[model samples]
Target: MHESKLIIAGGSGFLGQVLARYFKTLGWEVIVFTRSPQANRVAREVQWHGETVSQWTRELEGATAIVNLCGRTVDCRYTTKNREEIMDSRMKPTRTLGEAIARCKNPPSVWLNASTATIYRHTHGPAWNESGEIGATPEAKDEFSVEVARAWEETFNTTATAHTRKVALRTAMVLGDGPNSVFPVLLRLARLGLGGRMGSGRQFVSWIHEADFCRAIEHVIARAEFSGPVNIAAPNPLTNAEMMHLFRGLVGMPFGLPASEWMLEVGAFFLRTETELIIKSRRVVPGRLLASGFQFQFERMPDALRELRMRMTGDVKCTLPLPAI
Candidate 1:
């Protein structure tokens, strides 16, 4: 019997690479659709423009699963040109894929589209779940990020794919070992003695380990009942201060200096990124996943950070030395 095939659109980035490798290890033939096709890639690569339909659409004809992670990174300054590209990057590829799938004689059974926790309103109190309300408005400063997510998901949901089960993954900051991941950024700050709370330190940081992220994607693929938007985040949400403190402990650092909102704004300007990435309270929870009995491997910040440290440093036995819970 032939192994099942999985097609990943925009599978060139950090998360996409991780997912591609993951499903491939499970005996699935992974096909990656990327802009810059590398000669050294393990998975079969198909060059794509991301905006228009082409021969790449044929890869979707008889695939087991299709995952689209083609959005432009939201880590840079929200310039007018950048904002337009950000929206278009996500919207165009999503719509194009939907159209391709609809035209397929044997469309993939599941289609998991990338969305973000930023789609939820910035909240500090209650944890926003999959059923949470959409938070971005045209007048909001961080409206660009929210709008991009909204439009990406809307394109996925509205596009007619009767044979395919669609699931919008409202993911959070994924903590992993890769250089492009958020882990290295925080680790650098901690090593420089600046791994402290940002602004008021009360902003909630909803996150998930990379392992859990891959697992959740597989879980959704297996469970036919899970459709529409699903929160792919750890159930426990921590404040910015608490998360940083744990990161410090994981790296064996004792202390870090806190940054005020004004300081954050200045640093962001110099770094050419937005302070909204740090200041916004992303208090999201995987209510649907937990309710559906999806158990998280690393539910706590300490556990997740420790796992990341092991992967980075290759010291498997370096346990957490902090005080007990």
Candidate 2:
């Protein structure tokens, strides 16, 4: 019997590290392709420039699965240089991976590429599924973000890799205990009584717990029917106001202050981040995942937040058993 192997490109980041640990515990050999290979890494690291093909192409030859999470963090302000870096970081890696897979004698069974739920148009009306409207709204100030998402998917879709099963993971804001994750930032705000609604607070925030995110990825890899653009978000997406309210309650805080649009803009300028990340309405739902009968362990925000709080406080261990694939 051959041992299962999983190769993750750009696996040095937070999400990549999460997947590496999760899959490793499930008895699969994990290989991480990183620009900087550290000796104390969780998985075997292979150095490779994300844009070009090199000796690292050999790692994809007979792997069980390949997950591409290569992209620059979008947490900073969208300056001219940052925009170019963001687009190139995603497009080059996706194109390079596809080219490498085409050269493989035995390509990985499945290729899961990272995408964003922000691809959907900003909406306060109905929730967006896989077939939702994918345009930028002027109010959300998401023109550049939508442009990036469209190009990222287009690069992956146009890549010619017939033998490998491809799936674009339109992942939502994943809540986890990682230092770079959004959960801690929000938790800190809630504790400081600054956890309040921003810009009228009508925008919907779509998110998923880190555990369910891994499970959904496993489901996508195991299920043959899951292909194309699959939304990896929780079914229930609440309003920003509601989410902040929940956060305040979870942290045992009362009387939090609300921030207007101007306030958010000022804060964003100081923080060197964009307000679109907070103000955009991303009511994305996992239509494909749900239709395929995949269940989320943390469907509701309250449950997910409680679990994260427990883990943060050291009341619960982070070791989550992998669901049967």
Error of 2 at 24 (Å): 0.7
Clashing pairs in 1: none
How does each model score on lDDT? Answer: 0.87, 0.91
The residue-by-residue lDDT of candidate 1 on 1-325, one tens digit each, is: 8688888898988998888889989989999999999978768899998878889888898888999999888889988998888888998999999888989999999999999998998876688888787876332255777877888888889999999999999999998887579998898898789999989988888999999999999999989999999999998888888888877877778899999988998999999999889888888999889988898999887888888888778888867754332
**Error of model 2, residue 106, in angstroms:** 0.9
lDDT of 2 by residue, 13-110 (tens): 98999999999999999999999999897999999988788899999989999999999999999999999999999999999999999999999999
Per-prediction TM-score, please?
Answer: 0.96, 0.96
Candidate 1 has what TM-score?
0.96
* Over 4 Å off, model 2: 315-325
**Residue 22 CA error for candidate 1 (Å)?**
0.9
Model 2, residue 42: C-alpha shift (Å): 1.6
